[model samples]
Target chain A: MMTIERKPPLGKKVQLMATCLCDAFYDDAAVATVQVLEHLGLTVEFPQAQTCCGQPAFNAGDWAASRRVARHMVRTFKGELPVIVPSSSCAAMVFHGSLLAFEHEPDLPAVEQLARRTWELADFIVHGLGVTTWPGRFDAAIAFHRSCHTRGSNSAEAAATLMRSIPGVNLVEFGEAEQCCGFGGTFSVSFPHISEAMGRLKLQHLRAAQPQVLVGVDTSCLMHLSGLAEKEGQPVKHLHVVQVLRDALKNGGLL
Target chain B: MKFQPIDQFATTLAPEKRQSVYGGTKATHEKRTKLLAAQFAEPDHLRRLAGEIKQHAIENLDTLLPLAEERLKAGGAQVHWAVDAEAARRQVLAILQRRGATRLVKAKTMVSEEIELAPFLESHGIECLETDLGEFIIQIDHDHPSHIVRPIIHKNRREIAVSFEKNGLGAYNDEPEVITRRAREFMRKKYLAADVGMTGANFVVAESGRLVVVTNEGNSRFSLAATKCHIALVGIEKIVPRDRDLALFLNLLARSATAQQLTVYTEFIQGPKAAGQPDGPEEMHVIFVDNGRTEVLASECREILRCIRCGACMNVCPVYRQVSGHAYRSVYPGPVGAVLSPLLAGEHFLDKADLPKASSLCGACNEVCPVNIPISDLLLRLRDKGKREGAPSPGLPPMGPWALLASQPLVWKAALFCGRMLDHVPGALIPVPAFHAWTGCRTLPKWRGGEFRKWLRVRKK
Candidate 1:
C-alpha cells in the first residue's frame, strides 16, 4: 500500500520558490505573485537557496539527476510554511513529481513533508487564504488558458474563481478552452512544427473571443502562446493571473 | 536537429487536408463528451468500475484462460494458443491449408494489422478482402488505418472518391451516403464467395464461453454469415470474468468511441451452428495471440492491457490531431500508442523510441479514457525506460547539463548572470537549436533573470 500524507492547515507565513522559467522570462509574474500574497496578509519568504524543483530533468526521465536537485529543494525550504509557486506546472512537479523521482530514499519523509506544503498561486489565494472576493476594479476582457498540469486539480477552478472575483473583469469564453497549448517544455523544441500547429489552433480560439488579454496561471503556457502570437504578428498581451490581480488591487489601492 | 518520424509525416502532409483529418475526430470528441454528461449523472463511476473489472481479469488470467478455453472447446469450438505472432501466423496458415481455403473475408481488426495477416495470406496465393467500409478503402488504396475504430480518418471524402474512381468501385462521387453504399454493394459478393471469415473479439467471457464482437456497420456479422469457416483472432488480454461485466464495458465503450448508446450490431458467438441452426459457420476457431502482451504484462505498464480499443485517446490527443495515425508507424497510435508501441517493440525498442517523445504529456487522454488508464503517467514511465535502455533520444535536450545547473544554487546563480547576455541577442541568433525551434515561429520574452530575487531582497530590507 502507498503511504499517504495528511496536509497541514494554511498559515500566515509561506516560502516562495519562483520557477526557473519565472526567474528567466516572467519576473513580472513573480513580483505580482508576491504582491498578491502580501496583500492577503501573508508573509512571503523567498528562499535564495532554491534554484529549481528539477521538473525539466524529471520530465525528461532523468530521475537520478532530478532526485539530487529535488533533495536540494527539500533541504533548502526548511519550514512549516506552505511553498507558493506562481506556476501550477512547477507546483505539480514539487507535490506530485517529487514522489515519482524520490522512491524508497531515506529522505522521502522530508520530501513528502515539503510536498504537502506546496501550493499553486491561484489555488493558494482562493483556498489557502479563503479570499473569495477582491476589492479591485481594473477592467479588461480576457480569456483564461488552463494548462494541462492543472487538469486533475482544483487550481483551474481556483483561478476562475479569482478571475470572477475581480470587479468589472469580463471573463470571455472561447472554443476548446481545456485543450493544451502544446508547450510540453522540451516538446516545443522536440517537435516544433506540431507544437506550432497546436499553438496556432489555440490562438485561433482565443482570438475568436476578441479578448484584449490572454491570462493563465502557468508562465510556460503564457510564454508559448505569447511567443506564437508575436511571431504570427497577431500578438495579444499575455499576463499571469497574479499580475492582473495585483494590478487590479494596486489600481484600487487595496494593497 | 534530427527529424522525428511523426513531425516528419505531419509537416509533409498537405496543408489543406489538415482540417479534414481533425474535423471528424473533433466532432466525435465533442459528441462523446455531451453524451456521457447527459447519459450518466456520474459517468466516471462507470469508467472506474470498467477499469477495475478489466484489471481484475488481467490479474486472474492464469485461471481464467484455462476456464475460457475449456468452456469454449466444450461448446464445439477450437481454441489455439499462440506464444508469438509467428506462431499465430503458422497456426492460422495451417488451419487455412487444412480447410482448403482460397478466399478469405475480413472484418476490421487491429490485431490482424498487428500480425500483418492480410499481406501474409495474400503472399500465399489467397485473395483477402476487407469488408468494413473504412477498412475496405484502406485495403483498396494499399494504405493504413489512421484511427483504430475510424480506420480511414486521414483521408477526406474527395480522396476517397478519387481512390474509388481509380479502383473502379463506381464513378467519381464524394457523397458520404454514396461512398458507403458503394462499399456495401462491393462487399456483398466477397462475403458470399469467400470460404473463410476472420474477426477480432472485443470481449471473451470465461463463465459462459461467449465471444462478444461489436461494430457499427454489421460487417463482422456479414463476414461470418455465409462463410464455411470462421476464425477469431483475439488478444489474450481481451477477457472478462463474467458475462455481465459486458454491461459496464459496453456502456463506457460506445459512449467513449462514437457517442452511441449502443453499436448497431453486437454479436455473441458461443460456437458454430448449434444443432441445425439456419445460418452460421460450420467451424469456429479462436486463436489467442500473445505477441508481446505477456512481456508488457510482466513490466510496469500492465494497466494498458485494460484498453478496450475505443480510440478515445487519439481523438483528444493534441499531437494526434496534427499527425494522425500513420505517424505512429504502428497499429496503435496517439497517447496510448506513445506508451504501448515502444514497450510492445520489446527488444527492438530502439526502432520506435521516438513514439514516447512525440506527446506533450497533456493528460487529456486519461480524462477521455473509458477504462481509466493513466496514459500520461505511463508515457513518462516509457520515456524513462527509453532513456535508461540507451534508445536514441532525439527531440529531447540532454538533461544532464540541466541537472548540473539546477542542483546547486551558486552554479545556478552564475548561469543566470550569464543568461542576461541573451537579452542582447536577437531571438533568431540565439544559436541553440532548441531555443531556435521556439523562435522559428514565436518570439521570446526579454530575459529578466535574477530580477525577481533582487526585487524580493529590496522589499525585505
Candidate 2:
C-alpha cells in the first residue's frame, strides 16, 4: 500500500521479484523487466534468495500455506530497494494480498515492510521512474488484456500510459474491457470448462478487435489466453507487456 | 453431474445456454455501471453509506430486531420467530392451516424458496401458486430459479413456451408478449381464487414497523390486493435501523438489481389493511427467519449480510456468467451464493462447501457489489473456513507442499531445474491429474525456470 513515488528520483536500485510464473515458464518477461529498469538507469538487483510471492497458495484460500510461502518472500526481499514484479497480480500480492493474508499474523509488520516497496512493472515505469514517453518505437496494433487485478489500482492507467508512450504502438479497443480472461491461477485447472468459457469470450472480443498481438502485464492471464488461442489454432499471438516493450526497444536499434 | 461441484455442473450446460446467461448479466452489469456513473459523482460513497447503514443495523440487531418485532406488533401484525427453514415453513403452514386457506398466491420470494415452502405446503394439501411471472414459469415447469432477482433468467422464452404449453397455459407460443399475457391471465384466475398471499420483505424498518417489498411487474401488489390473509417471511438480516434508510436502500436495491432507478411497485405494508384501508389483507403475520444469519453475523464474513439481494455481483462475475446460477445450486446464486450458501448450510456446511471455490477471485463481484460486501475476501475466508472445518474440497494438491517448496530456495531452484525437463517430456507422459486437467484445453509454454537467476548471477560476476 506504499504510495508509488510519482515524483521521480526514486532510489536507482530495485529488487526484481521474478515471480513463480516467470521463474517457471516466462523468464524472458523477468529478463525484459530488468532490461527496462536498467534502460531507465536503475540498478536492478536480483535477490538470489527470492522464490514465489505465494499468490498461488494465497489465492487458493490456504492462508496458512500462503503466509508460510509469503513469509519467505518477506525474508528474502528485506532491503529498501523497491521490488519490481512483472505481473500485476504478483505485485498486488506483495502490496495488497500480503496485507490481507497476514492481517492477523505476528509477522504482519514484516509483511507490510515488503509491501511498501512493491510495484508492478508498468506502474513502476509510469509512476516510480516517471517514464511516460519512450524513445523506443514498434509499429503494431495490439489488444491489451487489462487483467482483473488492475481494477482499483493505478496499474491499469499506468500500463495504458506506458504502452501509449511508444510512438507507433496502437492500443486497440475491445468490448467488455472489465472482464477477466479467467486464468485465475488454479481456477483454470479446477474449473476447466468455466475458465475456458470466459477465456473463449475474451478472445472473441480480442479477435474482433483485430490486433496483431495480445499484450498483458501478467503472464498468467496471457498464458491462458494464448493457450486457448493455440488450442484452436488462432493466429493472433500473446505477449507480456514487458516483452512488447522489449520488442519496441529492440526495434528501436537497441541490442 | 446431477449434484456435482459447480465446475462439473457447468460443463453439462451447453455453451449457448451459458452465453444467454452471460448476455443477460452483462447487459445488466453495463447498464447499472453506466447509470451509477451518470447518477453519482461518487457512487462508491453511496455504496459505503449503504454498507455502513446495514452494518449498523446488523451490529445493533439485538436492539433493532426487538424494536422491529415490537413495531410490527404495535401495527396490529402477529409476529413469529423461526430459528431455521423448517421452523419458518412450519409457522407458514400452521398459519395457513388455521386460516383454512388451501389456495394461496405467492410473490417471488427467495425466502420461500429457502424454506421450500411451496413444496412443503403442497405436501400438506395446500396449493401455493406463484404469482410473479418468472416464479410462475419456474413453478409450473418444476424448475429451480437460477438467479434470485431474475428467476427464469436461465429459462429462454422458447423453453418457457414449451413449459407453458405443457402446463395448458397455451399452445406453444414463444413470443415474449404473448407469454406474459397468458401468464397474466392464468395468474388473474389464481389471484381471484386464492385466499392467502405470501411475500418476502425487501427491508424491515424497525423504526416504523413497515414491511417494504418491490417488484418490477407489480405482482406483489396484485398478490396483496386479492388475498385476505398475508404472510411475510423475512430474513433477520433484512432489518434496517429506520424508515428513512429505505430512501437509500430502495434506490440501491432497485438500481443494483435491475438498473431501475426505482421498481414499478414499492409497497410499504403497515400490517393488515390498517383501520379500514381500501385494500391489503385483513389478517397479517410476519415471520423473522434467522436460518443461520446470526452465525454469519458473528463470523468474520458478517459483511455478506449487507447484501440487498441485488445480483450485480452475479452480473459482473465471469465465472457466474459462464456457469449460470444453477451451477451454484443454492437458493442464492453467483458470488453472493458462493459465500452465503455455504454459511447458510449451517451444520450441513459441507454440502455447499464447493461454492466458495467456485469463483476465480477476479474480484469483479466485489467491484459491482451494491453494498460493498468484500465478496472476494469472503470467498477466500470461506475457503479457509472450509479447509479448517474439514469439508471435502476439490482434489487439488495440499498447499503445504507447494508452500514448503516455494519457501525453500534450494528446493525451489531444484524444482525449477526439474521444470525444465517438462519442456522435453510430452505433457501426456506427466502423471499429474492437475496437469492433465490443464492440458485438456490449453497448451503450456516450454519451461525456462531459473534462467533469469542464472543470467542475473552471470551479470553480477
- The TM-score obtained for chain B by all candidates, in the order given, is 0.97, 0.97
- Candidate 2 root-mean-square deviation in Å: 2.3
Note the chain A TM-score of all models in turn.
0.95, 0.95
Residue B147 local lDDT, model 1? 88
Candidate 1 lDDT (Cα, whole model)?
0.87
**lDDT for position B295 in model 1:** 91
lDDT of 1 by residue, B151-236 (tens): 88888899999999999989999999999998888889889999999999999999988999999999999999999899999999
TM-score of chain A of 1: 0.95
List model 2 lDDT by residue over B1-461, tens digit each: 01228888886888678878988998998999999899889988889899999989889999999999998898899999999999999999899889889998899888889888888999999998988888888888888998988988887889989988998987999999999999899889888889999899999999999999999888888888999999999999999998999988988888899998999999999888877588778999999999899999999899999989988999888988888898887899999999999999989888888889887788888777878888888888888888778876564556888998989999999999988778788777887777877778888877888888888878779
Which consecutive 10 residues in model 1 chain A have the weakest lDDT in total? A1-10
Candidate 1 residue B216 Cα shift, in angstroms, is: 1.3
Clashing pairs for model 1 are none
